[model samples]
Target: MRKRDLEIIKHLEMFRVMSRDDIVDLHFKHLKNPIGNANTVLKRLVRDGQIEVSTMHSPYLYFPVGNHIKKNSTKIPHYLKLVQVYKDLCEIEPPTEFIIEPQYKKGLAEPDIYCVFKGTPLFIEVQNSIYSSKQMEDKIKRYELLKQSELVKPFPTIIMITNTRYAIESDQIKVIQTPSIAHLIHKANEDSNTPPPPQPIKTNGNITFKL
Candidate 1:
């Protein structure tokens, strides 16, 4: 199997589902013709039985061969939002790489995405709802407790991306609202004094369709 095909399978197995556009954005953004190349690859993958597609939605979604996608499920919408955040991060310049739901030996806490930027490991959480003061405190406490144990060397920067305008800040964590995903990425990059990523060069010749 090709490396891209393997990556797609691993992503589907980890996230359960993703739309065609999501896949294109996340993996092929650097290509001269991203969407066109992605469509060609996806078609070949579907024909080879390595992946499957669902036409129940407008843009259509792709899934692992053996997995059944529940289009009507409430969880799917939230999952897609998380995927979008991942996709947006992928599109950012300077090329941010992420590990989904990191595993720790200390406990069972799994943050949505663990990304490292400018040598800083950041735990990013996507919050779709408001949290009570107590609820928020408990989460902070849990992270603090984990840090104190020193089970994971070098404490990570915890960042919460939320839909709410209100935010929380402390020595242990920082919360930023999600007015725009690209803006959020730019803010983080600026705060770290990291340079923006170079733009992809547009091809003047005919775009090749790779499968």
Candidate 2:
């Protein structure tokens, strides 16, 4: 198998789902005519049964061959959100050191985005749905245990990108709504003099800001 194709498969397995543009941005951006080349590569992979495509959505989605392919499962808001964050991180100057999803360790809690910059790990969770109080408490406790345990040295800051207006009570977690990629990248590159990302605005009969 080709090196780039192998990387694409690895990404599909890790991220669970992706779009053509996602694949292009991650792997082929440096190539000449990236979009066209990405299309050709994806078609070849699909023909070889190395990957499968889903046409149920507007912009078709792609997944590895062994994974279950269902129309309903094809669209995940959280996955899309992560992809957007990934794209934004890629644009940061000096670049993001690394972004990954952690494996399920014996005593470690898995986070949505395990982003590393300057050797610091930021455990980011993109919460699209509201969790009950008990659920929230249990999750916090798990992270707390992970922090106290000798699993990860120095631990990592947990940032929750939540959809609701929640007032959390955890010293280990920071909650925010609708965060920009630049802001996140800046957080990782603390000493770097990158300016703040532009905030988003809404237009519904009147102009408003997204906070």
Candidate 3:
């Protein structure tokens, strides 16, 4: 930074923001002999190319010539935190190129982690909501589509993982369903009288029916 540029920054850092009037008034308070105006200092900085006058975010704020705050909070961004939790629990590492908002024709589906497991691609959606029928239907429909070849193969195993802020376990975790698709379909349709004929339920000879 130029000698004067550094001095200006030290002044700006004193608060979240500063206006020309504030700086001019501060000048009078500091030097006791005011330049009597802020334009002089601003124009000087502008001429030296130490700062640029920006009018985008706020009305006329001065910014460094070409610097930006790239890095942010270490705690995950709010939108990704829940998704990250799913990845952590599932022990599934998401691909770097995976789309956070993967495009699906039916709706705006935001899978927490669109990654592959055991060479099979999967779509994991997380719900931090109190379970509802509509939410349940939406979650299962994706699976039904996958089952009927209505969707694509290596068909994304829809993982609907839920969280109960409290430890008392209930029917929250839909992501970890039984190994068999038939059983999963059965449980999914258990609430309704007629679901449909069970299709093929491929398994690796072992399944978890705990739910």
Candidate 4:
């Protein structure tokens, strides 16, 4: 797949699952380059089975090849930014799923980027600020509480992607990765046996303010 293609899918997979509006929102995120390409790529991925496509017509439903979406502590618009980053990374491997809005009552409240790498649930947060420390810690605690669920996994990481640093509760259980958008896009893919195609040279979007 092209780097852009992988990136788009990476973003698509971030939702618990997505509807048509979600896709349109993403179209602005990564597919402003041209027309028709988004639909074409979606069809191809569905045929390849790397992604799941649900035909709801008025609101198309799409998901990664998984049965369910995971947990996160972000809203949809906010999470889309993080998802874009993950998509760039998926030029090689699928980013583990993350839910920005943790569902509760259904009992999900640790809304960070949670992943099971090597059998551990690593919860990551890309923080641009420390003003929300206490509330963020509460989310971590909720993660621990929710880990008791047979459906929930344990082990978490709360990454803060920031320009400045601040203290966080050490007792709640978390780890931090400092701000690094290691655009290793070319690097990560090159490391893989399969390298993603080079991004097409372009300059049109530089003159615009995208949503």
- lDDT agreement with native, every candidate: 0.72, 0.73, 0.48, 0.55
Model 4 stretches with alpha carbons more than 4 Å out: 1-36, 39-77, 96-100, 104-109, 117-120, 128-133, 136-140, 147-151, 180-211
Stretches of candidate 1 exceeding 4 Å from the true structure:
29-36, 68-71, 93-97, 105-108, 165-181, 188-211
lDDT by residue for model 2 (32-58), tens = 899899989999999999998887765
**lDDT tens digits, residue span 22-131, model 1:** 88877788899998999899899999999888888767788887875566666666678768766666565332556767776544346777777656677777777788
The 10 consecutive residues of candidate 4 with the worst lDDT sum are 69-78
Model 2, runs deviating above 4 Å = 93-108, 132-134, 171-178, 186-211
Q: Which regions in candidate 3 have their CA more than 4 angstroms from the true location?
A: 1-78, 82-97, 107-110, 146-151, 164-211
Clashing pairs in 3: none
* Candidate 1: residue 177 lDDT (0-100): 53
Residues 11-80 of candidate 4: C-alpha lDDT, one tens digit per residue: 6655545554555555643665433565676778789987876564345556778745332223433454
Tell how far residue 181 is off in model 4, in angstroms.
Answer: 5.2
Number of the top candidate by lDDT?
A: 2
Candidate 3, residue 61: CA error in Å? 22
Q: By TM-score, highest first, what's the ranking?
A: 2, 1, 4, 3
The number of the candidate with the highest TM-score is 2
Q: List the RMSD of every prediction in angstroms.
A: 13.6, 10.3, 18.6, 15.5
Q: What is candidate 2's CA lDDT for residue 171?
A: 75
Clashing residue pairs in all predictions, respectively, total 1, 0, 0, 8
